[model samples]
Structure formats: C-alpha cells, structure tokens
Target: MSGGAMLSLDGVHAVYGRKIRALRGVSLEVRAGEVVALIGNNGAGKTTLMKTIAGLLAPEKGRVTFQGRALSGLPPHEVMRMGLSLVPEGRRIFPRLTVMENLEMGAYSRAHGAELAREYEHVFTLFPVLGRRRAQLGGTLSGGEQQMLAMGRALMAAPKLLMLDEPSMGLAPVVVDKIFEIIARINQEGVTVLLVEQNARRALKAAARAYVLETGEIVSAGDSASLLRDPAVQKAYLGL
Candidate 1:
C-alpha cells in the first residue's frame, strides 16, 4: 500500500452467484483526506466495487486494505468498526424509524455516553433540518432530506473513510447542488471520501481525482481536471 493511501484495492475481482462477473481486476486508491470520485454508467460495477471494499461481498481475487489492515475476509460489521462506513445507494434509511433512531442505529458499534452524544450533535450541526425533525419518521422526509439523513447516519460512525454511492440520484438540480456542497464540507473536515456518482459532471467538480468505470473495469483515471477535459470523457459523460 502507498504510504498516504487510506484505502487501497489491488487487482480486485468479484462475481455474483457463480458465473456473473462484476469487477475485473479493479485497482484504486483513496488517499487520506481526499475526495475521490468513481463515475460510471448504470451497469458499470461501481456499486459492486464499493460493496467489495465494505466487506458486504468478498472479492474472488486480489486484496482490499484499509489503514494497512487486510479487509479481505472480514465481515461488514468488522469493517465498520475499523472506521469505514458506506452510505449505500438509494438513501436506504429505515422508513419506520424516527430520524434520531436511524442515526442511533449507525452508532450501534460505538460506545454509549459523551462521545456518542457528541456525534449526534456533529451530524445535527451539519444538517440542522435533521436536528429539527429528530422526532419525525424517516419516511416522512422529502427526497433531499432523506439523503441528508442517510449521510448523517453514516457520519454517526465517525468513519475515517466514508464511501458514498449515487448520493444525488433522483433529486432536483438545486438539491443536488446542496448535496455536493455538503460533500465538499465533509471532505474539508478530514474524511477520506470515495464517491460513486452517476452525475459525472458534479462528481468531477467535487473530487480532486476520479476514475471512470465501464462494463466492470476502469477505463480512465486521472486528476479530475484532466479527466473533465478529456474529449472522450466530455463527450460520453459530461454531455459536451
């Protein structure tokens, strides 16, 4: 692993069922305190890669290391305990749970007391609306609010590496902007973010580095500015 890399995936491969291949020799690194974007089309194995890293799925080949610790055979809960949290796609907040309940679920592995209370305050500070609606059922919130709640829930874990998948999907343009703004703010506060997003343009703008995935493999990767300017990337992803 590189000295500064907080997360590293080396030639990783994952499959589904038995025959369906999802990731193909994927390799990437998320450096400490950097927001690295993974942009890809609908079926491009982006989520697969995220799941693999989070220990939701075991890779068939290669290695996944976080903070220099091998994560290959660990379970999801163990991975979470190691300071890696994933806010999965679809803002999967518990509909029946109140906002506060959902956030508490995120901290299940954490100790009870002052530290846990501080995490709640921290999340509320980031999304004051959540604080205001702490008693409301999560299902009652709007799409944007639900997204915020999901992010806040993940933050409750105090993760050093936060992986966000498709955070802006199915939201209005203005809402998307707000989401990205918060993402930048989170990164600035020292979280190493690995963001998988469908809105390639917004992802590139928010990220310092980016990788392009296609059909389960990485097709391009570079500094965000260079990737944004590449003719192929512009034409295929940026709609320019």
Candidate 2:
C-alpha cells in the first residue's frame, strides 16, 4: 500500500485573496491503497488543501500530481474525470432533487449505460439507506443520511483517490462511528482516501498515516499510532 504514490503535493502554497495566504509551503503525499488523514483545527487550512487537490483552487506555487500526471491548473471537472473525487465539508446535495437524482448527477462525467448502472448499484450496496430512500428529497434526510448521500455521490465517480472533507461533521456519536466504519470499508475496497477530519482520535485511528496542519503549515506528521501517542498531539488535539 505504501510502495506507490497515488498523489503528491510538493511545496504547495494556496491563497484565498491576493493578500491572505491559506497554505504555505505545504507538502504531503497519499500512497496507493492507503488512508491518509489530514487533521487540524477550525482555521487550519484543511478544506483549502482539499479544494486545491480537487482543482477548485490552484496553487500559487508548487505542484499537484495524481497518478503521475500534473493537475496544477485543471478545472474541477477535469480533475474529476482524472479519477479524484471530493466529498465537500458540507453535504451540498441539491435541495430540490430526489435521492436518486442527486446520485445521478454524480455520474454526469461517466458514460451512460451498463457501467453507470453498475456504479449506481455499487453505491446502493455501500449505503442501503440510500437505496431505501431513493425517492426522498435530499434536504429531507437526517444529517447522517445526508452525509451518506454525499459519500455515495462521490463514489459514483469511481475515483482512484477519494478526498473526504469533514465527513463526521454535525452527526451523533453513533452516526459518526458508523460513518468511519463505512470509510474504512471503502478503503478496503481499494480506493485510496485522503481524509480531512477535525476529530483527531477517530481520524488517527482510521488512517495509516497522519499529518497535523496549523496556520497553513504541516507541523507534525508520522504513522497514525505514533501521532496518537505523542504527548504534543494528545495534549493539543485529544484533550489529554
């Protein structure tokens, strides 16, 4: 799992406005078939890094490479077409759309036919609640259901690398546990995951390796178990 690099960011720098920097000389890599967690506080540039990788935002300096191809100025759609799918922080499903419709929208980049149908079935298999609620409006579902929908939507892309931003946000503890379980299951199925989570313990537990970001910088990085046991990480992120 760690032998090949699926994605890499070398000295990446990203900014919100001309003057406000969001990431500064940040660098990391996601190896093939590994779950890599990026954990940080509220304003720690976690979402900004995901957007940069997904091509919603471009780096001011450095490069983003996926599967050996550079993704520096590509549009989001182009990035998606190249096998990177991002489940954004908020469950931004179409409020007016039905569950099935929202899922269909996720397959817009894919060809229509048997392959698409199989992907739909795959999503349904991963999330049976979605299969049961196929006709429900996206906005009507519970927070956990909506989060499942978001993940299902991303899986529709058949991504080689799945980028999840705050998948546990605004959910009950049990729901969060279930979500993390599903995420681990997803990784087991061979989709490399780059997960951005503020829940440090859970994130560390889920990922093989972890990086801690603070004020646009990667302050700590190592194997997840070591980071979890580190005195600094425990005090700062785990409330120990």
Candidate 3:
C-alpha cells in the first residue's frame, strides 16, 4: 500500500486454459531488503502468483510493479533484466551442464568478465560444496546440493529481488534447516526475498512478514511472529 514497495501486486487476477482462475484479485508487497513469505496449501495459487510476478504467466487483470515500473506484459527475460528473478518450485538446473556452467547460465543477461567472476565467488562462499563440485554435472548432485545450486544460480544474476518457490521441497529436515539459513544469509547480504513455501512453520520463522493464501486469495496477513501464534493459522497450516 506504500510507495516504497520494492515489488507490489495490485488486484492481480490470472487464468489458466480460459477456464480456471488461478489468482483472484490478489494483492501483496515486499519492501526493499525484506524477506517476505507466502504460505498456503496445494493449488492455492502460490506458484501462479510467483509466475505472474516473474512474467512466466501474464495476469489477465491488475498490475505488477517493481521499483515503480509496471510489469504486466513484460517477458520473463525482460523481468530478469529488471532485477527480479524466480527460482521455480523444482531445482530446475541444466541437468547435463556442469555446476559451473549452470551458474554461468544464470548471468545470461550480462556479459562475462570481472563482475560475473565476483558473483561466482560470492555464490561459492555461500555454498562451499558447490565450489568443490564446480566441475560435476548438475544432475549428479544430491538433493540438497541441487537446491543450493538453484539458489546459487539465481544469485549469479545479482538480482535485487529473488523469489523462491518451495526451497525446502522434498528435502530432509536437516537439509531444509541449512537451506533456510542460507536464505537468511542471502537476505543479510542485501537481496530482498519473497519466498513461497509449503512448510509454513519454517517459512514463518525465516520471514519478517507473511501472507496466507487460500484458494488464490490472501486470506490473512501480518508479521510472521503473530501469524505463527494465530489460532486459525496454527490449526490450518502449522498443524498444531
């Protein structure tokens, strides 16, 4: 609702196959340098909202703005150049490419050289195992490693806002903990994050502010700590 929003969606509505509506007047915002979370059950349009913002799926109505620029019809590549990047639900790495190659692909919008090299070093610092396996094929990395690679690759682009979809999906508990920690550290380094995670408790813990989506609309929103303690949110999402 404020002009200082780093990313804002105003009454966005998206449809699929001319029949199903995935987003119904959804509106939310992530301010500069903040970690925000969107938590919901399956088919709640979490991914669709992320796609709309990333330009993977165009909204049939309403507007998406990043840094005061409207992004309704921009293509995904153009959105990336505007300093917004999305790491989709799965760890969609270039399976055949080596780890280093995958990281290079993240910076496709930029020319190769000193700046890219600096980003590479920063990614390696965040996930040292990735640095160790720089030559390994992406497909061969373990699940946790692949998740790390996904985040690292996105970071390679040096985005101002990074949207992560289910960063903890299908991973062991310990690995999920590590992944959330890395996310926090990434935010500490000045990258604003909008995370969509099914793991509500962990998502709330990692984010400062949060929104709870139900059937394609934001049903509730507040600071993460308060939502964590909310009776309805606890029973429905937190499984308490």
**CA lDDT of every candidate:** 0.94, 0.93, 0.95
| Residues 95-164, model 3: lDDT tens digits | 9999999998998888889988899999999999999999999999999999999999999999999999
Candidate 1: clashing pairs of residues: none
Off by over 4 Å in 3: none
Give the winner by TM-score: 3
Q: List the candidate 1 regions with Cα displacement exceeding 4 Å.
A: none
Please state the error at residue 212 of candidate 1 in Å.
Answer: 0.7
Give the clashing residue pairs of candidate 3, or none.
none
lDDT of 3 at 136: 100
TM-scores of the candidates are 0.97, 0.97, 0.98
TM-score between model 2 and native? 0.97
Worst 10 residues of 2 by lDDT: 1-10
Clash count for each candidate, listed in order shown:
0, 0, 0
lDDT of 2 by residue, 129-194 (tens): 999999999999999999999999999989999999999998999999999999999999999999
Candidate 1 lDDT tens digits, 152-174: 99999999999999999999999
Clashing pairs in 2: none
The TM-score obtained by model 3 is 0.98
